[model samples]
Each structure stands twice: as structure tokens, then as C-alpha cells.
Target chain A: MATEAKRTRKNAQSGIFAVFREQEAAIRRFVRRISPSSSDVDDIAQETILRALQAEREREISQPKAYLYMIARNVVRDAMDKKSRSVIDFIEDFAPESVSSHEPLIEDQVDGRQRMLLFWEAVATLPEQCQQVFVLKKVYGYSHAEISRKLGVSVSTTEKHVAAGLRRCSDFLDRRAAESGLNETRRRSAGKGE
Target chain B: MTRPEALSADAPDLTSEAAAWLAQLETGRLSSRDLAAFREWIQRSPRHYAEIHRLAELSREVNILAGMAEPLKAAAQRRRAVQRLWSIPVLGWGSLGLVATCALAFTLLAGMPDPAPAVPEPVFLVTPVGETREVALEDGSTVKLNTDSRMEVAFIKGRRNIYLEKGEAFFNVAHDAGRPFTVYAGDRSVTAVGTAFSVRWTDRELVVTVSEGKVAYGEAPARAAPSQASDAGKVMPASSAPVSSPRTMLGPGHRLEVSPLNRAELVERLPENVLSRELAWRSGFLDFQDAPLSEVVSEMQRYTAQEIVIADAELADLRFGGVFRIGQTDAFFEALELSFGVNVEQTDDNKLILKSVN
Candidate 1:
């Protein structure tokens, strides 16, 4: 019985690691999306993955990627909530003078600006209807029904436009990140999708 | 890339499927099976995860852009104006073409229709016993309704109004300065432009607690102005007659308690620990800090179908402090009996009575 339990634990650990190997970049991106600070993004992503692994060890996780996303979301929410309370720490983190680590604060700022510009350009490249739908639903926080009513389109159509917009933006960024060779880990997983 | 269609050879079907999942998941109504399937789909390819992550980033970027772009803000304003105009009963079928044209031109025009209309028929939202629900309003606001609560939602151009008929609800009002969000519980209404607050209406009293931002809590509009009362039966705006009733503007960590007998609204700034304990219902845990036995019983009654009653009046004032899961009341009773030297007599009719130890 002990041997069997050990074997099951080993299997669960391997399965969880496999999940990390496959979805780590995506999970990191998910965390980065919600995190207010770029520096916290990596920490939040690591914590999210670690929590998921710990949770999986105790019980079965039939949907590991979904579980990972959920954890990442919660981690972001907790970070934001904490940041709201510690206004001084938040200000210090943004300031360059507070940096004790080797990571240059200026690089992060430049990277953030570059990313924002890339995102805006990608959005501009979308079809007119898709751009409007994406802006209304995503930027303005309108529900699908509201978007449909405002745009004089069906709800399904609004969703389709949003999907198209998301696909274009994702493809644009992924390709750019690949070309720049900035995401070496992401490159390794690129072939695994096939 | 400029054409958008040429950006990826990745099947449009997959992206659209992910979009459908995103839409469904945001509704807060996905089943466990759907969640499992979504996980499998996302894990099937790194590309899938990339798309979802990009969707999130795009959403954030759009919000940022919304702040920067004057036209986008105007579009939202026009949409609200169009919604208000559409709700008018007097503008019948003859104005349909004009309304359609106005909606189409919402991007061009910045503003119109300053006044808000009376509340039309409100849509009722209810949560049965032991069931907590999160409802996303037409406006970006969200309401997490506690167990056994009922609320009426009325969305028009001017303001977003929610009437809590009975029970407790937490409102996360989306920030819209042009239109204020108000939650009316019994005779008191909690109003805010952008804030997070909870309102609990019980037979004993009405309580409003602010978790984030600022909220004004006071008596509901006692009466509407005579000029605004076009119809006798229609629910007019509560703010119509801004009588100088005692009002309390509470920030974070502040709570307003109004009891039926005591006409004075008690406003208190609780410490962080105590404030969290008070709002623990937002999570699934109930945190009690030296609360009276009677108060604990009332709080527990909101979550469970079983009624807890103190048989002896003396035991009602006995102070108790502990953290208990909302769903597990039997464990709470067991702990009370073991530690506090109380006898629990549970009858078959879902009644639990606490008596002094013999």
C-alpha cells in the first residue's frame, strides 16, 4: 500500500510538471496581464504555478491549465488588493531609486511602453467592425448583449468579431516575440503544439 | 498582418471556440464539466493559452485607451443617452427610425438627454436558501447576492438603481461619474459613483459597510418632487427631493448601522481586523470576535436552513468568538457545547436550541 501510494504521488508530480512545461509561458502572460507592476508579474506567475502544484499533489486536477489560470487570476487579485493598501510600497516599487536588485527599472519601463505600442498597432490593424466590437466589449467593459445592441449586431456576431480581434493581436505579438528572440522558453514550446 | 485574416494560419475555429469560452466564463455560470474541457483545450496547445492571455492584455489595453481617447468616452455617453431615449414610453414606433439613426451616430455625437427617467418595471434577482450568486448588471457593475436575498435592478440613462427587498448583498459598482449607482435597502439607500460596499437589511436593522472608495448612506428619498411625478404609480428617482436628512459618507473600513428603534444612524470606523470579520461573508467564512450568542445565531441563520435559538435568555448574552465555515453549523454547535459548557437540543423541525448545562 505504501509503494502504491508513493507511485501515485510520483505520477501526480510528473503530471503537474508536464503542465508547467506546457503552459508556463501562457500562465506567465496571464499573470502579467492582470498585474499592475511588471516586476510582480514573474513572482505572481511562479506563485500561481507553485500553488497549483501543491493543490494537485493533494487531489486530482482533471483540468490543469484551467486550474492554473484560476490560480493566476486569484494571485493577481490578492496582489492588487494588497497594493491598494500599501500606497507607499506601491510608489517605491515604481521609483528607480528603490531598486536593490540587478534588474534595471528603465528596461522594464521601455519594455512596457514598447508592448503597449505593439498592442495598439495590432488593434488598429483589426477590421473596423471587429475593432469597435473589441473596444466596446473589452475596453468599455460592456456585456455581449450590450455590445450587440449598441452595434446593431447579433450577440454571436459580436463574439465572432471579438474572437477575430483577439486572434490577430495574439498572433502579431507571438510572432514579434519570436522574431526578437526575447522568449527562448516560448520558442521551445512552439514546436510542442504540433 | 494589416489585413488581420493573414496574421495566423491557426484555425479560426479554435480562436472562436476560445472566445466563446471567454464569454461563457465571464458570465460566472460555467459548469464544472465546461471548466475541465476548457482546461483540456487550453493545454492542447501553447497557442491556445497565448490567445487567452492576449485577450486579457487586449482588454486591459482597451481600458487604458478608453481613458486616453476622447471619442471612446463620447461613444459610451451616447450609448447611455440612446438607452435612456429608447426607454421612454412616449417615443413610440414612429421614433424607431430616429432612434436607430441616433444609435448609429453614437460615435459622432458627444452628449444629449441630461435628465434621467423614472424607474421602469424592475427585473427581480433572487437567491434561495444556501445559494449565493454573483450577478453582472448591464452596466459594468456586479452584485454578489448572499443567501436568501432578493433585489430589484433598474438600469436607465441617468442612474443605476438596485432595491434590496430583503437580505444582504455586496455591490462592486463600476466607476461611472456621470451616473451614480444606488442600493436601497428598506428606508436607507447607499449611493456611490465608484466603490465597493455591502448592504444588509434584516428585521432588526439596516447596515451599510464600505470596503473600497466612498459611499453616502442615508434614508431613502422620502418623497419625490411634485413636478417629477408624471405618473402616480411609477417609481420616481429617490433623489428627487434632497431633503436634509442625516447622511453619512463612509470611506473604506467605515460602517453605518441603523436600527428601527434607534432613529440615529450609528457610523463607526472599525479597525482592519474587525472590519474584515464583519465582511467575512464575502468569503465563505464567518469570523466572530467576541460576538454575543444571540448575534451569532442571527448571522448563522442567514446561511443555514436550521434555526438556532437560545432557550435561556441568559445564554443569549454569552459572548463567543471563533471562525466557522458558513456551510458547517453542526461543527459550530459541537464546539460551543464542548468548550462553553452549553447543552444543544436539536429538534426534528430544523430547530437547534441552546440551554445552560445541567
Candidate 2:
């Protein structure tokens, strides 16, 4: 019930857009679950959100994140469908300067867990190229082929990056949870607080 | 409740399933067979079903997005089509967009005026064969629409222009210097500032003969079809060329003819009686002198509904000299039988057989 106030504030401030603003990060993460290429995640996220909004506009929806993830799942399939292409969609040298954040894409209410702070900081230390592929494939739902084509790498190279990146992030999460003496309760509460 | 390791293996299975589904989806015009296969695939596993449902949801979403963008694209495309339509010159009726629907609506709304312009400048007007027609003009003047000919007229300001689109018309143009009457035939517009002139156009030729007063000639672009008839009907004079090859300024009694395949040729100087020969069509008369017999039988067909057949090609080249009325062709047939050794016999249904009886 206390989180309700935060939800209303976020919703009231953004109007009909609150639903998408709330789940943009998770849907992107779901997209990464299938996509190994990080560059295409933002596009998939935008597409997923646009589609989700349309579904919402067309028919009232109760589960916003579920609906968004559903769209994200399809986007993942499409990204994978495009993955058959061995050639990269973008330039090999092109790299974004900013680190992608999995920190709650929506506003984090002050009364929530600070694990997100540590959670996202660990995400920043990843090797730039590996981090991007991992997020796009593992978090955003792009396929290994998509990551390879977008980053102009071999499919096997994309798979390695995604596997390595996720392993590194999981390791980081394990370490943080151990060092901070945090449990699933804290993680879930942290998710709820955000 | 499950560890993240379980989720890692799931990605490839999901990826492969997605690729397969997409390939099957693109197999051209969606069919019941495709749907049945898809349903079977969905029934294969709970995960597969879940994924298909997810994808179906995705396609639905993209369609809505495309829908939102459709109106904008349609409006832009419509604007472009209108710009292209405005570029055509045939309808100088103003404005770039005389939309077909709007034109139809306007025509209906503005009910057809009871009486349109009476002098219908037809796209093509032809006269009879072996017959010269003197067609009186709206003015007290007249133009002898020659035999087996066609002509086209277009009006521009004070200058009334006739494109002997094909065929010839001799103009007894009303004397008006303010507006030069022009006959536009193959490559040359014979202009009469206030004069009398004869201009004929064929598929491969065009000729102009001027009598009484000097006439200025302007050349038109060569046409595909040129004229075949001559200034003097009976003695066509070896398919006479025009009097001036370059169509130099013409004085009274000058003549010019242009072959479609060549530059203009100097035909002849007209005698004072030339007008009677050219204007004989006004009196329904056709004259022939040493003219090919072939041109005669062909000419015989037009006056009567009956078709005339010359049995031999040699008969066409044989020259004959005669003068007779053209409209009542049966009488002329008798005349031909009497003058030339040509016997006319009746064939079935509007057909007449001709024989060289001599």
C-alpha cells in the first residue's frame, strides 16, 4: 500500500505513459534475455513499448509488465529471426560511451533498498563490448546472430560474449549479496521499493 | 524459484523456435495448412505455445503502430499524385488538379448546355473519293474539302489555324488581314493574310496552291500521314510537288506540295480556271485525265454503297481521261463503260465486279 503512493506519483506525473515508463527496463531486460547484441536493445525496447502501448490503447490491460514482456518476447523472436545474417548491421568500430543501466528504469522511491546502487555499479565495470552484447542478448533479448551482425562479429564470438558477460554479472551479484549480507527478501523488497 | 542456469539454456531453444516459426510464416499467401502447422507447433510444448502467443501479441502491436502511421503516408502520397496530374498539357483548362471525380461531378452539376458550339472542329474530317466537296465556311467564304481527305482545326486567338492533320482543304478565306488564316500541313503552315489558297495533306505528302493575292506560308512539323489527291483532280500531274521547294513567299497563282519522305517540291503555277477544278466538289463533280484507272475504281466505291473491284493490278496503272459527276456513282459507272472499255457487273451484297471489255 505504501508503494501505491509512489506508483500514483509516477503515474500522475506522466499520465497514460506511466505504464510503459515503469516497465521499459524490464521489458528491455527480457529482450536481452534473447538478444546478445546490446546496440539493438534500445530499438527493441522502444518497439516493445510502442507495441505494448498500442495493445493497451486498443484493449484495457491489467498486467502492464506482463503485457510489455510479452511484446518483448516477440521482439526477441524477430531479432533472432534476423540473426541468420552473419554480416553486421552496424559498423564494427561504433561503440556507445554510456554504460547501460538495469537500475530501475522508473524512479526509485527513497524508502527502498540501496542494493540497486551497488547492483548497477557492478554492471558498469564490464568490458564495454562484452557488456553491450550481454545486455542486448541476455537482458534485451537479441539473438547471438543479432549481436554478431550488429557488432560485426562471428556468431560464436557473440555467444562467448553473452555467456561471459552474464557469468561476470551473476558473479558480481553473488559477491555483492554475500558482502552486503542481503537475501532474496532484500532483492524483492528493493524491486518493490523502486 | 528456479536458478538462473535453467534460464540460460532456454535462450537457444527459444531462438531456434523463433527462426522456424518465421520461416514457416513467410511461405507466401497464408493458408489453412500454415495455420494447421502453426497450431501443431503450438501444441508441441507449453513453452512453444507461450512463445507463439507472445509473437502473435507482437504482430498485433506492430500493426497498430503501422496503422497510426498509415494516414500520414496516404495523405503525402495523394499530394504527390496530384502534382503529377497537373503537369499534362492537353487540359489547359487551368489548375494542376482537375481531379477525375471532381470533373465528373462538376460536369453533372453543370448540366450539359443545350447547344454546344455548332462548328464541331472534329479531330478528323474526310471527303469522298473522286469527289471534290466545296464546303462553305461560317464566313461568306468556302473551302473545297478535296477527295479522299482529312483535316483538323484548332483555334488560337485572332489566327484560325487548320492542321491539315491529314488531307487538304482549299481556302477561299474571308479577306481579313487582321487575322491571317493558316493551313498547317506537313512541316509548313501556308498562311493567307487575305487571299485564296488550296492546301492538301496526305500520309506521305502535302501541297499548297495559292490563287489571287500573295500568301505567306509557315511550315508545320512533318506528320505521319500525308495527302494523295492533287490540285487538279483529273490531270493530277504526276502527283505534282508544290510550286516552291523551300515554300518561298508565294504570289498569286503559285503552287506547293510536300512529300512526307522529302522536302517540299514545286508543283505548278495554277491557271485562272484552277479554282473551278478545285471547287468542282462544291458542284459534286470529279474530273480525271490520264489518271491511273486504279485510282478510279477505288474512287467509284465512295459515291455508291456498293464496293467496286478492279480484277487486275495493271488496270490500276492504266491512265484514263474523263469528266463526270461523282455523287450518283451508278451513272458514272455507265459513263466509264461507254468511255473506257470497262464493263461493270454486279457481285453479291454491295459488291460490283469490273472487267476490261476492250
Candidate 3:
């Protein structure tokens, strides 16, 4: 509760917010480099920056970049922990192979998890503006009119961007599916071998 | 390439086309031509339907993302000041430490000058069964809480938010262009600038009826279902993007009814007279126009602890219409028996069972 109050107080300060906006692009790119997918870059960056701010408030941080990297590392670890718990639901439809297996079937899950990350990574490959519009409309829950106003674009433009994002993301996924035809073949062979 | 394709090769083109239709759906104005075209497209192949379903799933994913935005925004605002301090390499070690110390002092002093506005904690109000309460908010808005309803009101820095936890409430919101007022009910949110609207939450379904002004109603991240009908029976231009489910704005005399179980949404314009009759509870009256026996009983259940049931399935469908005072259940039963020829049997456990007279 004390830390929550402290974080709230720090958030209310304009000085920290100004610095955050200035360094946002850099932080985003940093996260993208190490991120499993672009879809999670913003999230990891946000978490890293928030933790860095908290650490800065607690003590003097000599090397801020190193501090940020450490925070991102921790955030990623936490996210992985959370993902493993819910990964079963995500892989339920994709991995019916687990049902036939007698042994604890751990290796098959690795492939399923990889495909799941790939699906989201394909979403991260969308053009910057398109991705922003998609995230605003889909993730941030902004309406077309609200997105138009926020992004300084017309309503028609917002709609176009959303459509473009959907097309591109779906195409990326399809392309990945086509390229990974071997995976399907291997899985089928594995099933027949059983 | 050997296996059956999950999506057709033309999936991209079809999805793009589906995206256009999805956008058109959100505009709440589907022309007969567009509707016919969409139907034709879907009937052309199962692939088209599959594409639309994927689009809907994607939209739901977006809604889930919206749920995480509050925390993302808070954390995204806090960036390190070390960038500015460390980027300047020209300063010697002594001056570098001096600069860091000054920066620290400036940061601490920045918040000391002015006091921030105090944000009031959210206040929860509840109404017991058979009771209705009216409350005036700090902004001079009024909320009339209906029987067995609960709501929480929070007025923060730049927004007025009300969470409709259970039942129904009629809101007379004060206009503030600087801050929007939003009512969160279930997975949907109804936002208004200045409007009189009633939001009812029952069995995980949300019913929003607007009496005055226009209000936006929809699910998070635009995953909302499309409006079934246009406002006041007047269809806007079909060229506009379709508003998705759980999301749509309604004008005066417009109502949005969403049932998640079936993912069905109905947005229709009503006559002022009909709207008034449907919402007669505001004036302490129960108005029914050929309502079924089951519906009438459920309405009665909200007012009292007494349970009402129809003994025969056929009796449940018998329609009854009348206007009666809220507490006059005895009169309601007497009139029903005399006109509808149904026998009312009261049990010792306060259960009223309606049976058809043979």
C-alpha cells in the first residue's frame, strides 16, 4: 500500500512524465530487440520504465540503462510465469495431440507455445501507423471517432488503417503457416507413429 | 501445400473486404444494398463466414488488450531522468556529480510548490428490494436507483465514472465538455456528455435506453456487436463503418439490448410514448402491455420477497396488460383472475402459483 501511494504520487509529477515521453521511442525499440514479439514490446517497455522510476525514487541510479535492462529482464520472467499458467487455454484448440499421449507430453507443448508466440509476433510486423491504429482500436478500446481525434486523423483514415492492420496481420500469420508446413507434417507423422 | 488450407488463398482479399463490412457494421447504418451484398458474400462460401468469425475473435482480443491499458498508461508515463544527465559527457566528474545533485533537488522541489486536487473515493449506493432511492452527485447530476440496484460513483481528475454493479438506475447527467461521464455495466460502457439515460443489468445482459441526448454505448476495444436496427427507425448512410457489438451510440428514444449468451444485439428507436410506458417505474408505476405472465412475475419479484410461479407452462405465456401502482399486487391478481380466468393459489411459504382454470 505504501509503495502504491508512492507510485501514485510520483505519477502525478509532470517532470517524470515529460522525460518518459522523450525517451519512449528509444525504450520501445530497446524492448523490441529482446521481446518475443513486437506485440509485447510496448508492454515490457512500460513495465521496465515504471520499475525504473520506482527505483530512482528509492535511491540514486548511476547507470539508468543498466537499471532499465534489469527491470525488463524481471518483467519478462514474470510474464513467462504468468503465460505458462494460461498457456493450456491458448493451446487447447491447436494441440489435440496431448490427448492421445500416455507420457507427460512436454515436448509437444514446446512447439505449441512457439506457434502461439509466432502468431502474436506476426501482429508486431504490421506497419507502425497501422499497428498504432490497431492497438488503439483493439487494445486501448478507442472508437474510430476517438482514435481519429487522438491521432489527428479523419474517421475514414482511421477505418482504413484498421482494415490495413487486419489484412496485414492475417496475411503474416498465413504466410507463417504456409512456411511452417513441415511442422504439420511432423505432427501428423508423430500421431501416426503413436 | 498438401494439407487443406486453414484459410483460402484469397483469405487476405476476403478479410480486407470483411474488414470493410465490419467497419460498415459499426456505423449502425446498413443499407439494404450493403446488407444484401454481405449476405451474398457470406453465402458464396463457408470461407467468408470463417473470415468474419476470425475478425470477431480478433476484435475480442482487442477488448482484452483494452482491459490492460490502464496499467500500461500509468507505467508508460514514468521515464528515467538519467538519459538527460548521462548524455552530457562534457562535464567533469565533480561537475557531473554537482549536476546530478541539482537535478535531484529540482525534482524534489518541483512537487513542493502546489498542492494537487483531492480525488474523492468512490461512493457505493444500494437500494433494497421494493425500495427506490434518488441521490444528487457533486456535479449536480441526479441518479434514481431502482429496486434492488447497486452502483458506485467516482469523480476523478478528468472523468466521472459510475459502475453499475447490479439492477438498474436512471441518470440525469450534468454536461461537462471537459470531462466525460461513463457508466460501466458488465463488459459494456455507456458514455454520455450530457444525457438522461437508464442502464439495466440483469442476468449478464445490458439494456441501455436513452431518453434525452445522444450517448455512446459499446464494449471495450470496439469488440461490441453491431446494432440490429437504426435509430428512430431512420437509417443513416450505409457508407459509414459498422459499429461492432457491445459498442454503439444511441440517440434520444433509442434503446440497445445486448445478450452475451447468444451474442445478439438489438438497437431500435422507440416512440416517446412507448419509451415512457416501458420506463414507468420512474414515476412509481408498473405498466405492462400484453406482457407474459412470467415477465410480469419477474417484475413483481423485484418489488417484494414473494415468489410467483406459473403451475402450467401454458399459463406462463398467457399475456396480461394493465397499469397498476407498484405495491398493489393484490389488485393485479384480482384483475388477472377476473379477466384472464386464471386461478391464483397462494402457498404458506409466500409462493403465488398461477394455474389455468379447466
Q: TM-score of every model? A: 0.42, 0.35, 0.40
lDDT of 3 by residue, B4-100 (tens): 3444454537778877766555434468897788667756655555455455433333332321221112111111111222243211211222332
Model 2 lDDT tens row, A1-194: 44853574466434335756755555565455444356778888888777766775676654443345556656765555454221111111111223111234222332111232232333344566765654444333445566677779986666556445444544555555554443442353343221
lDDT of 1 by residue, B29-135 (tens): 45889777866776665555554443443333434332212123233333333344335321121222233232221221123335645544456777777655555
Choose 1 or 3, whichever is better by TM-score. Answer: 1
lDDT of 2 by residue, B260-321 (tens): 67674665776644544543443344444445767766555545556788875445665554
Q: Evaluated on chain B only, what is the TM-score of candidate 1?
A: 0.60
- Supply DockQ values for each candidate: 0.07, 0.01, 0.07
Model 3 docking tier (incorrect/acceptable/medium/high): incorrect
State the C-alpha lDDT per candidate: 0.60, 0.48, 0.58
Off by over 4 Å in 1: A1-194, B1-121, B222-246
Q: State residue B44's C-alpha deviation in candidate 1, in Å.
A: 40
Docking class of 1: incorrect
Q: What is the DockQ of candidate 3?
A: 0.07
Most accurate candidate by TM-score = 1
- Weakest ten-residue segment in model 1 chain B by summed lDDT: B89-98
